[model samples]
Target: MAAKQYKAIGEEAWKNNVEKVNAELFIFTYGSLVVQLVKDFEDYGAVNKQLDKMGYNIGVRLIDDILARTGIDKCADFHTTAEVVAKVGFRVFLNIAPAIANWSADAKEFSLILEDNPLNDFCELPPKAVQEGLWYSNVLCGVIRGALEMMQMQTEVWFVHDVLRGDDVSEIRVKLVKILDEEVPVGDE
Candidate 1:
């Protein structure tokens, strides 16, 4: 399907099918979750890892929701995969379709430029956390990684820039490692 068609599907689903929630409640809840993670781990890096793991679990299930909600077929190429993810997946989930940009010459990597991240809404990392390399939205990288893994696209996703980290825009870099045609169970392999 074309990117525009995906966008239309996302818009329609978000408008009519999905249940609405209080945006502030969601944001505050996420903020408190981060706070609790930081306190529990006492290490910014560990907090980030925990957030990523949580998001990965969410994404593993989220892909199923996207497939059921939009009924789009698997993307045939990396370019189309990028488009469908930007136009459909993010939109249906966050109501914000980040801009896809900075494609590599090989087209194996690209950046998702989030002009506005709901997660970063009203979030500011402290100086110590910033110095310790806390990616305020690291969860998103895990989400993308897990979601694409389900799509048979092995990818490395991470935050290259974060608005909460004082960058002009939040950027998530996604690099396609390889496409998996088949897999072995770990012990069998």
Candidate 2:
């Protein structure tokens, strides 16, 4: 139903409606999801949690769009999948401002610098503190992370730029830093 409408519009049309669609999408989500999901929301905690949850929700739904756009129903390997995500998925679908960097060979993680993040204007924070806010709309990170995980690539996504501190025209950075496995210590020090 709704998915059909979205698909019918095509990516070209969607890009054209970036401003209008994004604005309307914000309004629709604000009115429906934010207001309805969070009860008695007053502080940053409630807002932040809600936004992250909202991103999770959107991530679930966005899987459909990702499939439609990429025609990738499945991945043969994580490396191939991450390449697809970095090259096609993020670049084409979301129209991210900054160029992304892929440092992971195993395809377990990747990173990017996001310029002119869309969610920063609605909320502001220092570059170091951007992820600390409750009202921050970081659902896109969660969306990509969750969506890719389901697609068989366990990944973590996050932002590096905080656009609220007059950091407008800044880069939106996401990292896929590797997780070091804990090694067993030798018997004697």
Candidate 3:
């Protein structure tokens, strides 16, 4: 099955990579950063947008690392790309593989169902944050958007469900806007 292959590949890639960090420390640091953002902005929407922007920046850099580590060549289609993102990408980086589901009729959109979200581990939104409709994992949406963009795939990513907000399942929706044509540099052209 694809899942088994993905797991094996992910595990191998993870082991080969020497650099590592403690999960607890990483999660806690991210949590602290989120709290600070909330305090500074005092508006949940603004904070969410800021977090997305930050994640977008991170994603742009991360895709290069991912390509180098995974050695996966350009994906031929969105379906293959989705599999790579869900199976290899998330598994390698987060140690959790979200399920790809809810493909649209045209296959231009899909949902990622995260059964386990590390960012939410030991995270509980304060009453104010919840009241203000803060999405604790907004950064994830941004990351996906940014990473896809670098791959010449324009997409809109957003969280549709959050367990922190009392949703039964955490889900992120990704809609493909368009695939960009590869551009040659001035001299290369």
Candidate 4:
């Protein structure tokens, strides 16, 4: 189910709404939403799950917008999907300066290790960060899993490293997992 739509506005119109744009800003503010929304909703335990689902919902919608923007056809396989992610998705959709060469393909999936993570490097999380639990990039992870699922591929999002600590560099890894099993349509009248 979709979230409540507040004041429908077009993409072009959105640019003028500074507060709304800042309200949905993801790069430097992913955690803030999770923290605030959890308390606002009064549900902390389900935060991660909600984040994942929300991310997937974003992917489902943004993938179509992205494909339309780049004029690229749907990728047919995992490799092609990964290529699209690096060349088109990352570059156009996220406006990321991806070197594109450092990305690697593994047995189960491809990994894009950004030499500079804009989200993490954009701002420093306070030492002894007060928020409870892990500060994972739930939005990005959700987008990837959601977009891939739209392309009919199953995926899992996991965090391999965090730069919150004094690690010289942080690493974030995502791997494509298995296809979801088909379920019979059950009816409740």
Highest TM-score against the true fold, candidate: 1
RMSD of each: 2.4, 10.4, 1.7, 8.8
Per-residue alpha-carbon lDDT of candidate 1 for residues 1-189, written as tens digits (9 for 90 to 100): 777898898898888778888999999998999999999999999998998898888889999999998888989899998998898888887899989999999999999999999998888889999999999888888899899999999999999998898899999999999998867778996
Please report, in order, the local distance difference test score of every candidate based on alpha carbons: 0.90, 0.52, 0.88, 0.57
Candidate 4 per-residue lDDT, tens place, 79-183, comes to 666666655555544545333233444546555655566556455645434244444455667788888787767888654555655555555455667765555
lDDT winner: 1
- Arranged by TM-score, best first: 1, 3, 4, 2
Ranking by lDDT: 1, 3, 4, 2
Which candidate do you rate higher for lDDT, 3 or 4? Answer: 3
Q: Is candidate 2 or 3 superior in TM-score?
A: 3
Displacement of residue 40 (Cα, Å) in model 2 is 3.8
Instruction: Write down the lDDT that model 2 would get.
Output: 0.52
Stretch of 10 with least lDDT, candidate 3: 1-10
Q: How does model 4 score by TM-score? A: 0.65
Q: Compare candidates 1 and 2 on TM-score and give the better one.
A: 1
**What TM-score, to 2 decimals, does candidate 2 have?**
0.57
Candidate 4: stretches off by over 4 Å: 1-31, 38-46, 97-106, 126-133, 179-189
* Clash count of each predicted structure: 0, 9, 0, 0
Model 2 lowest lDDT segment of ten? 1-10
- Candidate 1, lDDT over the whole model: 0.90
Pull out the clashing pairs in model 3. Answer: none
